[model samples]
Target chain A: MTLRIYIPCDAAAVSVGADEVADAIRTEISKRKLDATIVRNGTRGMLWLEPLVEIEEAGKRIGFGPIGIEDVPSLFETAAHPKALGDIAEIPYFKSQQRVTFARCGITDPLSVHDYEKLGGLAGLKKAIALTSADIVKMVTDSGLRGRGGAGFPTGIKWNTVAGTTAAQKYIVCNADEGDSGTFADRMLMEGDPFLLIEGMAIAGLAVGATKGFIYIRSEYPHAFAQMNRAIEIAYTKKILGANVLGSGKTFDLETRLGAGAYICGEETSLLESLEGRRGQVRAKPPLPALQGLFGKPTVINNVLSFAAVPTILAEGSAYYQEFGIGRSRGTMPIQLAGNIKQGGLIERAFGFSLKEIIEVYGGGTYTGRPVRAVQVGGPLGAYWPTHLFDTPFGYEEFAAKGGMIGHGGIVVFDDSVDLARQARFAMEFCAIESCGKCTPCRIGSTRGMETIDKIIKGEDVANNIELVRDLSEVMRDGSLCALGGLTPMPVLSALDHFPEDFTPAHQAAAE
Target chain B: MSQLPRKPTQKTEAGAYDLELVREIAASMKGLDGPLIPILHALNDRFGYVDDTAIPVVANVLNLSRAEVHGVVSFYHDFRHEPAKRHVLKICRAEACQSMGAEKLFAEVAAALGDSAQVTLEPVYCLGNCALSPSAMIDGKLYGRVSKEKALAEVRK
Candidate 1:
């Protein structure tokens, strides 16, 4: 019998020398003449243990990780190597979270459609093939899966609108432009379980009346782009995608498009603009993408996670998925724990866990071994939460009520050494740089916001400057055309509201 | 955060580009829906950057205006106007990377690679490898928990 060895090809894992480790393992296997085959899979979301190698023994896969080249020889000698972990699934970090979207990651070959189907893949699309389009839309609408790409818009409602619209060529646009700093769920899914994205997109096309789909990924994610494209090619060959999907006479073909480092392109309208080969400026509302999107046709544009959630919603039934999460933010969220943290990785759970519990239990606090100072929930535009407000539950309304957001479900941890005032300044700076310039509050106001924050930092008219910032933030929040301009104030105001002492002259003096 | 990266001006040295190759690539991709963005990206990949020279070629193939082509090349941060050095090192400068001393590390990298066209250091907001904070990508391969020595060795080679 041939022994099977598993190593991750995940981008995060590769960042920490997984590729090198994989090479070393191959050399050792050949040199030792062992009966072994290597299976390069994705991360188990235990990023701290990356370069994680798993060896299957009697139907149990033993794990070892943070592996150096030297560790390879020992892995062959015995499963008792110093880095050896008993079954990876048994690890507290891996076992704790309820993985719905990322269920097949780190388990099967990403490019293999057969491996995907063997692991309960295509069940949703297969189920959808048998149902009425309205029933499929009704199933998703009943599942309560909101957009996981920062904006918590209802996914089912977006689909329903497109389903109702009449168009000759409607499109299902998969927003794989995962631009947020502290997120990688979409990347992981695309690279690890590419077929799931394919199935999800296919189901989406069948749900709506759309026959074509496009996945717009950021250019920075070269690996994911390549992997998704390959998976799509295999999907076409397997008859999972093409002119006839699953021999059901339904037509849903897929293509992957790359974005050239424009953060604003993550916005649906801007994405549509970029997809049309134009400057990625935000288009106005009242003509939402659902009604007039992508070459002026009805389109169902959704985030990678939003579409990924559909397969499971259809497979497990809406009631099963809906029962797990709290409030309206149903199903599971693949929460990314990034930055200044000891155990940084992905944690997917039903949307009700407190922020404090996640940080301590999953994150293991700051990497520098210092006390945690602040945690910026969501991306750059998200509010920076002080430790006191850490009890806020991980839900859309819960976070919004606390002046924060679960944007793309990214929570970046910061240590005691961090200064919140500088973070506030960067928020404005980021908005200024990435803003599409379609709105005043996001474009010009960001520069002004930066100047005001700089004045506050300099201890020159700190009181008045703070007042001025608050005024600017209100305008940006209410008056901007899109969320880019509208939400730029979240980080700025959160820093001011929570850590007022950080802006004081004495605090500046102490830091300097 | 202070200096907005410089954008490409309208001036062009037209004779420098491989016009035939640009036409071939543009013509090959123009059949796709919204072919302009794809054409610019292909040109960028083939030439390592897009510039005023290739813009006219792409615009002509897609039958769009020169301004339309240039607007796209300028709009995106990834579409470089000049040929990158032997290597390009992108340090993650977003909040996650910043919290993990990426700014200081970036400063160190910039200083080490000064005046050397052999390598160029650019700040990317995020590479989506946040689990490994303070990450850097040199020549399209990502390295986690990057230090000055690792970054310098990777890019210099």
Candidate 2:
């Protein structure tokens, strides 16, 4: 039997030298003249041990890594390499995850349709093929699935609205533009199991009565973009997409479109505008994308995770998915642990895992060994949570209650040495840099906010400037068109509220 | 499939790029849905950056105004107004990477390679490779857990 070895081709894995490791493994096998075959698979979410090499042994894949080219020769020399991580699945970080959407990610060859089907890929699209569009919408509704792209809008309602609308040519657009600073779940899912998203979009097209779909990925994700385009090509050639869709005699074809680097384009309306070949400017709501979207026709826009969830929800039934999570926010969220953390990686869990547990337990605490001073949950617009609020649960409403958001489910931890005032300024600066400039409040308020923070930092008229920041934030929060402006104050206010010492002038406090 | 710049191919009317070639590329992609962005991307791919002269040619083919075409190109950070250096290096300046001392890494890089004509340094919000914080991509290749030494060595090569 040929010895089967698996190594990840996920971009993050490649970023840290997985390709060099793969080459080393190839050379070692050839020089030793061993009967071995290498399979480039997706990451297992054990990112701390990335460039993770797995060898098939007695039906169990044994893991070893965060491997280097230097460590390659030792692998064939002895069964006991120092970095040997036993069984890949048995690792606590691997075992702890309630892997649902990510179930087949690291296990199968990403573009392999046979591997995708054998591991329960098309079961959802197949199941949806037998059902009416209304029944499909109802099934998703019962499952309590919501948009995974920061906004907690119900996916079924969005589908139902589009299904209700009668359009000559409806469209299904997958928002694979994962632009958040700490989030990579969408990228991981797209690169690791490109077919799941293809299957998800196909099921969506069938449910919404659309024949064409597009997955809009960011220009930054060239690896994922290449993989998705290739996978879509394979999908079309195999008759799995277009004219037949797994021989069910229904039609659905998916295309991958690349976005120019604009953060606002990640917004659905802005995305639709960009897709229409215009500058990514936000459009006012009244006609939601469900009713008037993509060439002024009905569109079903869902995040990669939201669409990827459908396959399992359709295959296993609504009740099975609904039973996994806390109230309202049903199903698992792939939480990303990033920055200043030792075990930073992807952690998918049910909705109630506390921020403390995620950061300390799964993340293995700060990478610097200093105490974690603050954890920013969500992306650039998310609130800065001081340690006192670590008990906050990881759900939609729960986070909202604490004036924080589970936006895109990304948690970025910072050590005690950080200055909150600097972070607050960076937030404003980021908003100013990325704002679509369609709305005055976001465009102007961000610049003014940055100047005000600088005044505070200089200790010149500190109190008034600090008050002005609050005033400016309140205006931007209410007046801006979309979340880009509306949520900018979350970080600004949260920093002032929790870490006032960082904002206070040393001389002024001493005088007081 | 490549997102990075390629070598300038076939000179144009203003000694910048080929005008007829621009019209041909634009017309070829005009049949695509939302073809304008793809058309601009094609020009950029061929010339390493969208030449200003090609704007009217592309606009004429797509029947869009010069302003509309220029607006889309200038609005996005990825579209360069002029040719990028031989190597383009983008450092992640977003929140996750920031927490991992990317600010310091950036400062060091800027101080070193900021003036070098061989490399054009740029700031990117996020690369979706956050698990490996302090990430930088040079010439469409990603590097993670990047120390100042590692980043300098990679770019200097």
**DockQ values for all predictions?**
0.44, 0.54
**A131-163 in candidate 2: lDDT tens per residue?**
999999999999999989999999999999999
Clashing pairs in 2: B12-B17, B12-B18
Sorted into a CAPRI-style docking class, model 1 comes out as acceptable
Docking level of model 2: medium
Local lDDT at A252 for model 1: 87
Q: After superposition, how far is residue B69 of candidate 1 from its true place, in Å?
A: 1.0
Interface RMSD measured for model 2: 4.0
Shift of residue B156 alpha carbon in model 2, Å? 1.7
At residue A44, give the lDDT of candidate 1: 89
Best by DockQ: 2
Q: Show model 1 residue runs off by greater than 4 Å.
A: B1-16
Q: Which regions in candidate 2 have their CA more than 4 angstroms from the true location?
A: A507-512, B1-16
TM-score of chain A of each: 0.99, 0.98
Q: Please give the range of 10 consecutive residues that has the lowest summed lDDT in model 2 chain A.
A: A503-512
